[model samples]
Structure formats: structure tokens, C-alpha cells
Target chain A: MMTGAAAIAAGGAGSARQPRNAALPAVIFAIFALMPAFAALTAQHYLVDTGTRIIVYAVAAVALDLLVGYGGLISFGQAAFIGLGAYAVGILSAAGIGDALVSLPVAIAVSMAFAWITGVVCIRTKGVYFIMITLAFGQMVYFLATSLAPYGGDNGLTIDARNTIAGWPVLKNDTAFYYFAFLCLLATYLLCRALIASRFGRVLRGTKENATRMAAIGFTVQRFQLIAYVIAGGIGGVSGFLLANSTEFVAPAYMAWQQSGELIVMVILGGVGTLDGAIVGSAVYLLAEEWLSGLTENWQVIFGPFLVLVVLFARGGLIGFCARLRLRHG
Target chain B: MTATLFFVQVLNGLQLGVLLFLIAAGLTLVFGVMDFINLAHGVQYMLGAYLAVAFYGVVGNFLFALIMALLASLAFGLLLEFLVFRHLYERDHLDQVIATFGIILFLNHAVRMVWGAAPLTLPMPDAFTGSVLLAPGQLYPVWRLVIIASGIAVAGGLYLLVTHTRIGMLVRAGATNARMVSALGVNIKRLFMIVFGFGTMLAGFAGVMIAPIISVEPGMGTNILILAFVVIVIGGIGSIRGAFVAALLIGLVDTLGRSFSIDVLRLVMAPSPARTVGPAIASILIYVLMAIVLFLRPAGLFPARGR
Candidate 1:
């Protein structure tokens, strides 16, 4: 059942030997690490703000790749966990509790709890049904957020101040917050890389490659998938926590299906299953979106066809395309 | 609830159900036959409303506008199939989902560009303009009843078309096993085009029928599109019967839950908490139903593919 395009995309370190550019990830990180300096040099505070947003989304997209690319789970509800995380911060803060130590754990725990409950139900189905059920769950969360009037409901809630880190307002400074987000992104990426190279990762990838075979070999496929889903949800929660702090606002729109779709697009565009690719995809997508919308309000009219053409012609996404180009030239 | 109010709600629920069925019928058929997930299906419904409005401006008659809209929708759908979707049928579901999502984004924005961002409306036809008495002092809008009638009629017609005709047989066989059907000398591509076109038209039809009541706006399809997906999932993918039953059930549950959840909750909980929780619960009721259905029957109620 493996198509040529899928085969090419799935050829991460496991199948094909690399072309000896292992420093690609380090280079990307180095670039991100130096972005703040670049922003400072350019004296563009908006660039830092936009970079922080990209880093936050990159964290979410990387987590999604863990499920979609490696675990063979296409969850349309990943944004729900992010929303849960953000709402945890917003609700606790609104109730006069703005400590990151308390709110961060609550955010992660709540999202994981949701992931566990919904994952248990969602893992029962496969293929299109899985996609639809995840979407249903996401919409349910979105509506729940809209109905929470005490927390500002559909109008959304704005925090008076960002979460204090151990009674310190280190995050109140924009540069400091950007660095914090960058660190979170780095941690998330490294964590994903480690997870994908572990015994657990091997089993998850094996199940993805052939679930029936894994089942026949006495592996409970659902358990591994559920664990992966929960892990992804936790990471998504972390991103959500950062997102709330970044904007100092939490809205139901954060968990809208469109956001989920954009996350999926990021994964696909960056080359699904590729951790660094997800990061790059987020950067490209957000930057393009910001740049294009500035050009015309109807930018999606152009962006949409571009996506279609990419899916049609660019089988493996940007990373895949880069790989092909290197192979041709080198 | 009062009997009249309950009856009126039920009619509203039925109207909503029929509209869902019209959208889901085509959606499920495409999924069943081609295994293609068209996220753009909702935009087709939006297009239908927009086309109806455009045609109405020219024809100045609702009936003629409806016919022209349907025809235009069919042609537009076929064009999309020819241009974009035709290449996607062979790709995986992820590819189909992404490509169709792109179509959704394009069309939604395209409509906004062409029609402006303002909400547009079509007046109810003169023939179905007023309210009709169902019981003493229980009057309902004639147009809503008309929508319900037409939806049911479309469903009945779809049932006949899917069950009786040669194309229907091919569709059934394809849903059961596409490769087997194609191997039997069936032109799967042509079958796919036909199925895609019909699904697009049904979605458009639902949009046109509901346009008079709801504001015709850009991105109108995205909300209902999700509902249709829920219906298809609950009904069981690839099963028209499943879609019909699920759509109506969802319509009733969603409508009734929203209308009476607070009252229902107040009996067990305090009024304040009930008020806060009721709408949230009501909005998620169908999704909860879907989760339960999937847990109970993973393949859905009437899975076209055998267990």
C-alpha cells in the first residue's frame, strides 16, 4: 500500500542513508538562536513578536508530527489540547492564580487528561473515521470554550499580566519571553528527537508501518498510540501555555478547526515526521501568511492554489524537495 | 415545554436534519465510492447559495434561480474535479485532506473577493412566504416546511438512484471494494466524476434551500461542514442509510439539546451552574454521541464495508 511519494517521505534515517549534512538541525537552531540578535540589529520589535509566535506554533507542530508522522495518527483535535493548556492558564489567572509553577502543571495535566479520555475513544477508529472523530472532539472543546462566560466566553479573556515565574516577572520583558519561547521550542525538539529514537519510537514506527503485524506479534497497538497521543497533547499544552503568556490573552478561536488545519499544513509543508521540518514549516507558513496578508486581504486565493500545487507536485514537502535537489546536484 | 413550542422545534430539527442529509448524502457517497475526503464540500454548499443569489439577481424568480444554481454548481464541481481532485483520487487520505483543505481556503476567499465580505440574503419564494398552522395557534413558516419536504424528497430520490440504477450498483460495488469493481471493467474514473458532481450538487442544494433563512456569507459552509462530517461518521462512512439516520438524529439532538438543556439541568443542579454548563453540554452533545457511537460500533451503524 506504500505509494512512491509516501515511501520517499518516510525515508527518514531509518531507510535511506543521509547525504552527510547532519548539521542541518544544528544550523537551523543556530539560526533561531541568533534571530533575536538579528531582530535587535534591525530594531524591529514586531519581528521578535512574530518569531515568538512562530516558535510557539513550531512547538505545537513538532508535537503533532510525533503523532501524525511517526505514530500514524492523524489527529484533527491537537489544537484542543493547546486550547486546554491556554484555558488552564487563563482560568487560573482569572481566579487570582498566576503562578507558572501551578498553572503550567495544571495546563499540561488538563490537556493530558483530555487527551487520555478522548484518545481512548478516538484510537478505536482508523483512517477517515479517526480524522473526523478528532475533528469532532476539537469542535466540542471550541464550543465549550465559547460557552465559558465566566472566563470571557466567545469574547475571549485577557490577563492583566503574564504568568510570574516563581514570583519573578522575567517573562514581562519581550526579549526575555522570546528567549523563553525559543528555549521551549529547543527543549520540545530535542525531546521529540530523543523519543523518536527510543525503543518506544521504534515500536510506534513499526505499528505505523504495519499495525496488523505488530498486533500479531503481541503488541497492543492502541496502548502505544494512546501514549504517543498523550505525549503530543502534553507538548501541545506547553505550547498553549507559552501562547497564552505571549499574547496575555486566551480565546476560543485559538482552538478553532482552522488552527488545527494550519498545524496539519505546517507538518505537511515542513515534511511530516521530520522534526526540524515541522519547525521550518511553521516558520515558512507563518512568515508567508504574515507577508501575504500584508500584500492583499485575499491572499488565501493565491495561497490555497499554491498548497494544492505543492501537494500535487511536491510529494515530500520542502524538506523532501530539498533532499531531492541535493541528490541531483551533489 | 409547551406542545406547540416542542412541535415547532421538532420541525426546525427536521428541517436542519434534511439539510444535513442533503449535504452528507453526496459526501458519504464520494467517501464510500472513491475513498476521497473532500474538505471543500462545505464550500460547494456556500457556492450553491452564492450562485443562487447571483442567478436570482438575473432571473428574478426563485424557481429559475434554483435550477440555474444547481446547474452552475454541477458544472463548477466537474471543473474542480477535472482540475484538482482528479489527481488526488490515487493519493492517500492525508493528501486528499490537505488538497481539499486548500480548495476550501481558496474558494472561501474567492467567494469573499467576488461577493464582498458582507452577508447576502435571498428572499423566500412568494409561494412559501407565510406561516402555516400545524395546530390551533401553532403556526410554522411555510418556507421551512418546504425545505423539509424538498430535503426528504432529495433523500428519497437519492435512495432510488443509489439502489436501483446501474450507476448505483457500480457505486455500491465500489464502496464495498473499489479495486474489485475496477477490475471488473468498470471505469472508476468516470464513476468518481459522476459521484463527485452529484455530491457537490447535493451540498449546494442544501445551501440554496437554507439561504433564505440564514445569512449567505463567506465561510458559511465550514460550520455545517463539520456537522455533516459528524453525521457521516455517526452514520458510518460510505453508508447513505447511515448518513440519513445520523443526520436526522443529530439534528434533533442538537436542536433539542440547545433549546432545553438549561431547563433539563436545573432539575438536578442549581440554576446558576446549570445555566453555565447547559449550553456547553448542549453544543457538545452530538460530538459526545459520535464518540459513544464510535466506541460502541467502530465501523458505524451501517458500515458499507463489511466488518
Candidate 2:
């Protein structure tokens, strides 16, 4: 059932292709890549910070889409992995292992281990239960972090310095880190695109559409889904790493369920199951939040209703809304 | 720990358990009947407490305030159902979660805007103000006793309603298969409204009742909501009896663990290490219990749905 869904999705991709618009996303990305440089040149430090946040969260949102949209796994604990990654960096740096190479692997390993254990129990459930169980696991992790009094606990940990690459302060400079993040985002996009097109990806997508049929066809549905979850988790961990460095602090609040909900909003607001949509969603979401907060302290009072309207009226989110408009115009 | 301290905490745990049962009962029923997960159910609880406070300010009588609060909560819940929840019944769990989460955000902030960010307190009724001595040097408050007695009574009443009443049969039937009940000309929509409204009221009732003892504040319901979810999952969804039992178990375990975890750990390890490890373990005890339950019985201890 899922294999057929994949084929149909692939067919849609082919039919929906427009030659002129093929490079639109790339052009948009290039503009985004240059945003920080423009900010730095203009001496807009706050802009640089906001841009870095967008890139980091965008990376996490894209990873989230891979699991929720493509793989049919709705996780409410993506922030847990991100927090784990952030904590990995913090704990290691505190222990004097401040190298990017060491910290990155440690983050990935910690997140992967957590995902493996939690995903085992979480995968057995489906639908609403799946969402809640994932949430419960996330809360469990948050509480554990809060109890770590030795490492700041509820007060959170502060990094002494940003991570260095081979003992050079390559990542400390705002422009360099922004460019590094952009490169990572680009690589992540390409890698996710490749993975989704592979034979493995096909099987994974199959399980999402119809697990029973896929199982009947002798595919190990659980294994594929688990791999997808781990991959998503690892990517989320990368987002945490960026977030910690960006904020210069890591807290249990990073993994709270509210953060997870915001990540999902980013996924849906962009349009689910689309790689580019994740980036678009993140950019739109974070920008709107930043803009709204500037307008009022209680921006969510208005934003909440706006979200309800979006979910009800806009089926496929902003991308779908735009697509409909263009079709009518065309 | 002294026996008096132990006994006092146990009673406290029981009281907490009862409040959880009231909230969880309605939650599990809604899920069982509609196949819906309402994260905003906690907001209903918060609203209940807020309404109680408002009503009390007007009537200045505990009974009048309680009744008004319950009615207000029912109306608010039905309003939400009519406006937002009705559209979501057919949607996936993710959509339900997100929409409900949005509701939580809106309501929490709205309450803050109206009630301020500080915790609000409902004064205990003068009639239930004094303490009754349970043991030597152990005096428990009358209001807490009232909560315990009322919670158990409600639980008993619910058991009777579900097992022996005509509506109970329909509820059980609905839990098993909602479509089948609808096919039987049971007016599933009306049933849904009753179940939803009743659940909302129960949660609200819990909030109002506990307001005097605990801080009545914005976002007060979120943590408790998660705890209620754990109870329903452990008790087996759709089972009132399961919710009742699970709520008590969790209340006892969590309350007792928080109080005695360090003491328990001290027997096996040094005091310093125990102090650190104790609180962490106590916080996670319910989850560990849940994991164990899931391993043994994935559907929970008494699932409404059969194998």
C-alpha cells in the first residue's frame, strides 16, 4: 500500500514539475545564504542572530518532516533529541573536549541512543497513543535534565566558549558560522532528497501509507520506520548543537513539549512531506514570531487563532494556498 | 519516617489520587467514545477553577459557586466543541494534538491577561476549615477529607452508572466500536456531547476543588494533564475502573516516592549520592511504572478494547 503511495507521490512530483521554477528554491536558498553576510556588512548583529536561529530551527524542521510526513511517524519528542544534542555539547565542552569533531559525534551518539530506546516502545503504538507516548518520553528526559543539579539543572548550563574546529575559531565568527550552517543545511537537504529516492526510502514511505500491506509483502516495516526515526532524531540533534552555540546556553526548556509543538507548526506551515517546505515553514514561522513579538508581548493571543484558521482553511499550508492561487491565475 | 508522617502522606496521596481519577475518568471516556485526544482538556480544568473563583466572588457561597462553576465549564466545553472540536473528529491525531495545543496556548495566555500571571487562591469554606486528628500529633484538614470521600463516592457512582444503567450500556458499546453504536440508532452525536460535557465538568470540578489547597494559576493544568494521560494509559483506556485504580496507584507511588525516595536510597548508598539520585528517581517513578506496565500489558491493565 505504501509502495503504491510512493509511486503516486513520485508521479505527482513528475507531473507537477515546471522547468522555469526548477531553480526557484535554489535561488531562494542563495539569497538566504547571503542574508547574514549582508547583515554583517550592514552591522546588523541582531539580524545575524535571528538568521542563525532560522537556519538551526529550519534544519530541525526539515528533519521532522522526514519522519511525520514521509514516514507516517508523528513524534512529539523531537525537542528531546535536540536537547540531548545541546547537552552533549555542553557536558563535553565542560569536560574540556571543545573540538567540533568530538562534540558533534558525542551529540549524535547520545541522541541516537535515546531515539533507539524510546523509539522501540514508541513505535509499537499508533495514532494518538503514539503522540502521547512520545510526549511522555520527552517529559521523562526533561525531568532528568532538571534533576542534574551538578550541571546546573533547572538553572541550565552556560558554555564557556563556542566550539572550535581543529583548535581554530572558525565557528566563532558570525559570518563563518552562518555560512557553515547554510552549507550543512544544503547538504542535509541533498542527503534527505537522496535517501527518500533510494530503495530503502521507498520501503519506508510504503510503511507510512499502509503498514499491513507492506508487512504482507515481506518488508520489515518496523525496521524501516525505526531507521527513519533515528535519522530524524540525529538531524534534530544537529539543530540542538547549532542552537546551543547560537544562544550560548542550554536548558531543559529546550526539550519541553511546547518546543516540539512549535517544530510541528513549522512542518505543517511549510507544507508536509516537502523538503523545501520545511525550510519555507521554518523561515515563515520564526519570522512571523519575531515580527509578532515585536508588535506585542502577547502575540500568541492573535497567533493562536491564526493557526486554527490555517489548519481549518488551508489543507496543505501556505505552499498549497499559493499553488491554488497560481492555478487560478494561470 | 514517623508513622504519623507516613499516614498523613498516604492520606494526602489518596486525596491527590481522587482528584486525578475525576479528571482521568472523563478523559478516558472521551478518547474511548470519539477516538479523540484533547490536550486542551487541561484548559477545561483551569477554566473550571477560574469560574469557581469568579462565581464565589458573586455568590459568596461555596455551594452556589460550585454549581455555577460546573455549569459554566459545561457551557464553555460545549462552545469549544461546537466551534473547534467538532471539525477535528475526522482528522488525524497529529492535527488534534496541534489544534488542542493551540487552544492551550490561547486559553493559558487569555487567562493570564484577565487574571494576571500570579497564582489565584480560593479560600476554603468556613464550614470545612478545621482539622480532625487521625493519629497522635497528626491532624488532617476537614477539606482534604471531604475531597477524599467525595472522590471515592463519585467513583462508586460512576461504576454503578457504567455497569447498570441504560446509558452505561451505550457508553460501553461506544467504547468497543463507535460506528456500531451509531448504526444502532443510539444518537451518537448526543452521546458524544454528553460524554464530552460530562468529562469537561469532571475535570473542572477537580480543578475547583483542588484550588484551595494548590495554587490556582495559569498553566496549572498542563502538568496535571500529562499526569492524567499517564493514568489513563496505565489504567487501560476506556475503563473507568482502570482509571480509578491507576489514579490511586500513581498518587500513592508519586507522593510516597517524593517523600521517601531519599530514605529508601540511603539504605543502599551513601547519603550524599542518595540525595542527588533520590529526587530524579522520584520524578521518573511513574514513567518507570508505566514502562513496566507497557512491557507486561501493552494495551494497559484493563483496556476497553479486547484482543
Candidate 3:
């Protein structure tokens, strides 16, 4: 019904969206690949840290875009999946299992298991109910994390060390960890783009537009969404794994509803439905947090109204705005 | 737990229930009638308490402070409606969520700016002070009973207003289908304003009433706001009756669960495991209940007529 400005935001390679801006992803990834080198030259090691954080969150953002943008499944519980992922790493590391081989699979499997179970329930509800239920589930997961006193509970758990890659301490190096994160982001972006281009993706997108029609066409709408949800959750787990390793800590706060909200903000900030938008949105949001908070302690006071102004005027987010500008200039 | 102790817990649950209902009533109506998701509604609640504290300082009268605080809350709600929410009625739910989330951020911090980051307090009136002996050793506070009675009165008054009034009829019809009512020559915008303002006042009222019992602090409403959402969802989006039932149910379950989860777990499990698992289960008990309810009744307990 709302096939107006919002539908435009729900863009793909070939739909009602603007011309395929393939160069955008290339530019973004190239920038990501070179950031560490730039940091080396500039002697801003913190820039590497910021870049790694951006990459880790970008993976989750890409996953979130798959649901909120492509599928019209807005799960407010994205942070829960991330939390589950992070905690998997934290718990394993605390148990003296610091290898990625064990921790990585454990993280993805745990979050996917959580995703599958919750998605079974979450996919049944539609629209606002979906949002609320996901939120409720996210809160449940957050509370569980807070209650785990053995693994540090509310205080969160600090890893003894960064994860080793197959008996080698590759990720122990800051530069290597940054590259690992960048690789994860790259892989996630490509994987999602491939998925979206498949027939399954088309069916998922179809359900978003009109579920009744898709049902009539003999597609199991719920199955497609549930798979997408689980996939998104796995990606969230991967993000969580990196998040834990990068910081060498995991906390229940990582799964706070506010974190989920911020992830949504990242999705919308770049423009939803587009993987390119997801990455850009993550970089921009994290950068803003880094830059703005440095300006003053009360940066959100300014950020809050700025967000309002953005929603009021910037319909398609930063990426959409840029597209609009380019079109106007053309 | 002893019978008297259980009874005390039930009363406490009732107190929580009525407080939740007061917040949920406004929240459910706005959501039902307007289909707006105002995350900032919690801050409006916080605003109510803060305003009451500020007014009490000036007026030095609890009743007068409550009245002034309510009026101020209504005014502020209308202002927010005019400035922000009025434009968002046509947008989808995601946009509504983001915009309101921004308001929550602004308001929570704005609150800190106005009142320092430290928690503030409002003294209870002398009239409601002291405890009444309900049994041989059970002494219940008078103020809690007052909160319970007042909450019941508000709920009853709300029920009457919604069932018997012209505005009530419009609201019910609007919840069923807003566009149809708008098309039928009713001023849906005005109806929205009334609902929003009234909802704001109800949240504020809850804030004012509970101020004496709980510390008034920044971001205090975030957690309770979540509970209110849980209430409205379980009760059904647009049904006041559902909200009442769900709120009280949640109040009881949550209160009782926290009080007895350890004991309940101890019966079937080892004491060490029970002690460790008890608080965790207690905290998530309401969510578990909500998940079960959603699985059973996706639309909620008493969804208003259409949606």
C-alpha cells in the first residue's frame, strides 16, 4: 500500500529503484581495504580500531538490511543474535577455548539456533506485532545474559586473549584482526547480494510487497522469511564473534534494545534494502558516534534532533540523498 | 510463602498492575486509534513525575501539584503532537518508531539538563502516611492502598468514559478503522490530538502517583515503558479491557515470580541450581508468558474491533 517514497527506499539491482550504482560498493570496500594503511601512515592506530568496529557492525547491518529492507521483516531483536554470538565467544574463551575454529562455529550455531526457534514464533506475526514480539524476545535474551553470574552476568565477560586462527595467533595482531573483520564484511556483503539476486530472494521480496499474492502463487512465505531470519541471525552471530574478539569482552549491554535500535538507525541512515546502503550506514553511524561524542559529553542531545530532522526530510537516508543529488545534477 | 505473605505480594502486584494500567491505557488508545508508536511516551511519564516534583516545590501542596503537573503534561503532549507526531500519522510504523526514538533521546537528556543527573524525590502527603495492621503481624502501607484504590477509580472512570461518551464512540470506531472514520466526516486529527494528550496525561498521572514510592530519575521510564508495551501487546493493541487484564496479570506474574521463582525451582531441582537459576527465570518470567501468549493469540488478549 505504501508503494511511494518508502518503496523506493526498498530498492534492489533492478526494481523501481534508481539506476544500479555498482561503483558505490566498490568505492566503499576499496576505502575499507585501504583504511588500515591510511591509519599506519597517519599514525592513528585508533583509526584502525574505529575501522574494525565499523566493519564488524557493518556485517550485522548488512544482515539487518536483508530483513528490514529486502524482506519487510523488521526484527527489533537483531541485537539479541549479536549478543548470542558474542557470548559464545566469551564463554568459550573463558573456558580456555580461544581458537576461532571452535568459537566461530559455536557462535554462528548458537545465534542461528536462537534465530530458528524465535523466528518460528516471530515469523507468524505480521507488521507491528512482529516488531513488538521481536522486541519482547530481545528483552528476554538480554535478561538471560544479565542473569548469567558464572560468565560475569551484568558485568559481562572479558576474554583472556584474542582468538587464534587454527593454532596460529593471526587475529592477535591488531592489523590482522582489522583485515579479518574487513574480510567478514566483504564476504557478508557479497553473500547477501548473491542471495538477493536468487529466485528465493525474489520470493522473499514478493512477500514483502504482497503476501496474499505470493501465497496464491504457491510459495511458502513463512519458510522464505524464516530462512532469511536465520541467515540474518547467523550473520549477526559472525558480527558478534568479531565484536567480542575485537574488544576482547562480551556484555549483555551489547544486546540491549537500544543497541538494536541503533542497528536499525544504521540501516535507515544509509538507506534500507540495499547492501551498499547498509555498509555506508554502519560506517557513517559509527563514525558519527566517534566524531560527535568526541565533541562533547552530551552529543546525543544534538544527535537526537539531528535524527528527527533526518527522518522529517531525508526520506531515503544518506545513500538515497546522494542518489537524489546525482540525479538532480544529471 | 505463608498466606499472609502471599496476600501482601498480591497487593503489591495489584499496586504494580494499576500503575501499569494507568500507563498502558493511554499508550493502547493512541496506538489503537492513531496507529502511532510513541517510544517517548515513557519520557512523558518521567516528565510527569519531574513536573510534579518541580510544582510541589513551588506550590507546597500535593493535590495542587498533581493537578498542575497533569495540565502541564497535557500541554507538553499537545506541543509534541503539533511539532512532531502530527506529521508522522501518514508515515509507516518504522518511521514512527525512529522519530519517537529520537524524541526519547532528546527528552531523557533534556530531563537530565533540567533536573541534574541525580535522582530526585517527592514526599508523600501526611494524610496517607503510616501503615494499617491487616493481620496479626501483617502491616500494609496506607499509601499503597491509596495507589491501588486510585488506580481502580481511574480504570473505572476510563471504562465509563470510553463506553458511554461521544468521544468514546469515535475512539472505538477509529481503532476499528481510522481512515473510514476520517472519511465519514469526523475530524480524525482532533480525535488523535485528544487521544494523544489524554494518553500523555495518563502516563504523567502514573509518574506523579508513583514518584513518592520510586525515585524520580533520568531514563527511569525506559524500563517501565518496555513493561507498558508488553502490557498493551498482551492485552491486545486497542482494547482497554485487555490492557487492564494483561497489566494486572503481568503485575501478579512478575511480582509473584520474582518472589517465589527460587522456591518453585527448589522443589524440582538442587538448591544450588535453584538459587542460581531462580533470579534469571524470575526476570524473564513475564517475557516467557508473553511469548506463550503471542504463540497462542497473535493479535493479543482483547484486540480492539478491527485491528
A139 Cα displacement, candidate 2 (Å)? 2.0
Please state the error at residue B215 of candidate 1 in Å. 0.9
Residues A13-132, candidate 2: write the lDDT tens digits. 321232224465787588787897788698877887788888899888889888887787888889998999999999988899888899988888889889998888888876555676
Please provide, for model 2 over B164-213, each residue's C-alpha lDDT reduced to its tens digit, 9 standing for 90 to 100: 99999999998888877899889998898889999999999998899888
- Number of backbone-clashing residue pairs for each candidate, in the order shown: 0, 1, 0
Model 3 chain B worst lDDT window (10 residues): B89-98
A100: Cα error in model 3, Å: 0.8
lDDT of 1 by residue, A62-120 (tens): 99999988887889988998899999999999999998999999999999999999899
Poorly placed runs, candidate 2 (over 4 Å): A1-24, A38-43
The 10-residue segment with the lowest total lDDT in model 2 chain A: A11-20
Number of the candidate with higher TM-score, 2 or 3? 3
Error of 1 at B219 (Å): 0.8
Reference-based lDDT, residue A244, model 2:
85
TM score of chain A per candidate = 0.95, 0.92, 0.96
lDDT of 1 by residue, B112-167 (tens): 99999999999889989999889998888999999999999988888898899998
Could you tell me which residue pairs clash in candidate 2? A2-A206
Supply DockQ values for each candidate: 0.58, 0.38, 0.55
Q: Can you write out model 3's per-residue Cα lDDT over A6-108, one digit (the tens) per residue?
A: 4444443213365658899999989989998999998999999999999999999999999988898988999998999999999998888999999999999
